[model samples]
Target: MLFLNRADAGRRLATRLTGFAGPDTIVLGLPRGGVPVALEVARALGAPLDVVVVRKLGSPLNPEYALGAIGAGGVRVVDTDAMRALGVTAREIDSTEVRERAELERRTVRFRGTRAELDLAGKTAIVVDDGIATGSTARAACLIVREMGASRIVLAVPVAPRDWIARIGGAADEFVCLETPAHFFAVGQWYADFTQTTDEEVSAALATTRVT
Candidate 1:
């Protein structure tokens, strides 16, 4: 199934997650694309919304191909198989992490400002993203949230490959994926309006969460 947009997809996802709504539940979106989708979920569930800023550690040669991801609290998830196959050395991986971690911090400040990060301790943290490709970012996100003391981690997304759902499912207490098409090539292919989500849009989405 194709989504009209991230907002539409989010509304549908929220319906499936209604049972989890309450004071104990918090929705964390992986910006900047996930923020738009997550805003709808946060509103529907009447839960607080937060951004989980994670940066993809892309291959030096092919920047689009993520070797892994880096998230808050210095959590990092690397695909050892991908690294070995591509002959990526430890030094290269470290260099990439340094760059991505810097960006991750910048985004955290840009999106959150003076507001301290939401305390996930003893709370059910539902992590949302626009979609999953290799699942590296989502995996990293789950680990990061868990490190922050979340009692449970739920990874939610609009679309993902069936294989990816299986691969990353173990990382969270629950994995909720709206679309798991076998022919999935990229997340954008399943969206009618797959425009790039901007920082300004992300901030606007977060603003709605504050007043909700």
Candidate 2:
């Protein structure tokens, strides 16, 4: 099914996640695109919403390739196999991590402002993304949430390829992907209008979910 947009996709995805609504549940969206989709889920579930800022440690020569990712609180996940195959050095990884971590911190502040991060200890942490592509960043998010002491981790997205389920399923306690197309090319292809979600939209969505 083609989604009208992320908001529409999110509302549809939220229906599949109705059973997870509770005080112990916290919905965390991967920023830039995932926040709008997550807002709908949070609203439908009556759960608190937050952004989990993570930066892709792109390959030095090919910026599109993610060799690793860095999350909040210094959480890092690396693909050693990819690094080794690409002849990436430890020094290169460290330098790339430093650069990405700096941007991650900046985005965390920009998106969340004064809102203290929700303590995920013993809570059901639901990580939401608009869609999954390479699944590296989403895998990194699940690991980071697990490190934060979450009792359970659920990875939810509007759409993904079947390969992603096989790829990152181990990281999440439960995977709640709405549509897993066999011929998936890109996340945007499944949407009618997959425009880039702006920073203002993300910040506004977060404000609507802020604890009063």
Best by TM-score: 2
Over 122-208, each residue of candidate 2 has an lDDT whose tens digit, in order, gives 999999999998897798788788877899999999999988877785789999998999899999999999999999999999899
Whole-model lDDT per candidate: 0.86, 0.89
Model 2, global lDDT? 0.89
Per-residue lDDT for 135 in model 1? 85
Question: For residues 1-212, could you state the per-residue lDDT of candidate 1 as single tens digits?
Answer: 88999999999999889989988999999988898999999999999899988777788898767777777767777878998999898899999888888888898889887777888899999999999988877877887787678999889898888887676756799988888997888999999999999988888877778633
Q: Please provide TM-scores, in order, for all candidate models, with all chains considered together.
A: 0.86, 0.91
How much is 143 displaced in model 2, in angstroms? 1.7
lDDT of 1: 0.86
Model 2 misplaced regions, further than 4 Å: 61-65, 79-87
Cα lDDT, model 1, residue 132: 93
Residue 197 C-alpha lDDT in model 2: 94
Among residues 3 or more apart in sequence or in different chains, the pairs in candidate 2 whose N, CA or C atoms overlap within 3 Å are: none
**What's each prediction's clash count?**
0, 0
